[model samples]
Target: MTYVFNMHDAKTKLSKLVELAESGQRVQIARNGKVVVELNVVAKKSRPLFGEFKPLNIWTSEDFDEPVQEWIDAFAISQSELELQSNKK
Candidate 1:
């Protein structure tokens, strides 16, 4: 639905008008009984699909799936701390 609002009412009810505009409603703001500005929902820009063509022989490194030793040690310590905290409750 299109909502028409005068300048005074538009200033007071701006938030609600903005919500209505954002939900695809056309909101009109007028001065001296004439429409001055229009608010409407902006359409989102579409993204183009990248790399649709077939790539030749892209291979990942052997250690790609392996966890770092530092992170493993930290994870173990975090688990131990969590267990201690759970036992105290």
Candidate 2:
């Protein structure tokens, strides 16, 4: 079904018009009695999959998932050592 509404009428019924368009009906808004714009349900986009960056020429190193030494050392320190370091700051 197709629905047409004048500018003022469309403004007051904007939400209803959107609902109609989303339900697969054609909705049009007019200005000065001539149709000028349409309301449509936009097609939803799919989320990109994992490792989809290859098309963009981006690559990761083999060691990207390896444990980082600095992070390991930070986590290995004792709670007292962390408190002493904070006090020194």
Candidate 3:
């Protein structure tokens, strides 16, 4: 079914017009008895929610999460040098 409303009537009853359009009925707004604009219900798209987990097809070694040996050794050396300088002061 098609429902037509004049500009002033459409503005006052906007919500009712939207409801009618969403229910698969044609709705039109007119000016001086000539149709000017139409109202339609846009389909809602599905979206992924925040923090949704999706797995990637990638692999890593068991030690990938561990700190590198060279970095650990450098840090230890820096720490020992700092301690020696503090002891001398």
Q: Which residue pairs in model 3 clash with each other? A: none
RMSD of 1: 10.1
Tens digits of per-residue lDDT, candidate 3, 5-86, equal 9999998999999999999999999999999999989999878887675967899999998999999999999999999999
**Judged by TM-score, which candidate is best?**
2
Worst 10 residues of 1 by lDDT: 46-55
Give candidate 2's whole-model lDDT: 0.91
| Tens digit per residue, CA lDDT, model 1, 1-89 | 88999999999999999999998889999999999999977789776578755778989999999999999999999999999999999
Which tens-of-lDDT digit does each residue in 24-87 have in candidate 2? 9999999998999999799999888998755666799999999999988877786669889999
lDDT for 13 in candidate 1 is 98
Global fold similarity of model 2 (TM-score): 0.55
Better of 1 and 3 by lDDT: 3
Provide the lDDT at 19 for model 2. Answer: 94
**What are the runs in model 3 whose C-alpha is more than 4 Å off?**
49-89
- TM-score against truth, every candidate: 0.48, 0.55, 0.54
Winner by lDDT: 3
For candidate 1, report its TM-score.
0.48
Off by over 4 Å in 2: 51-89
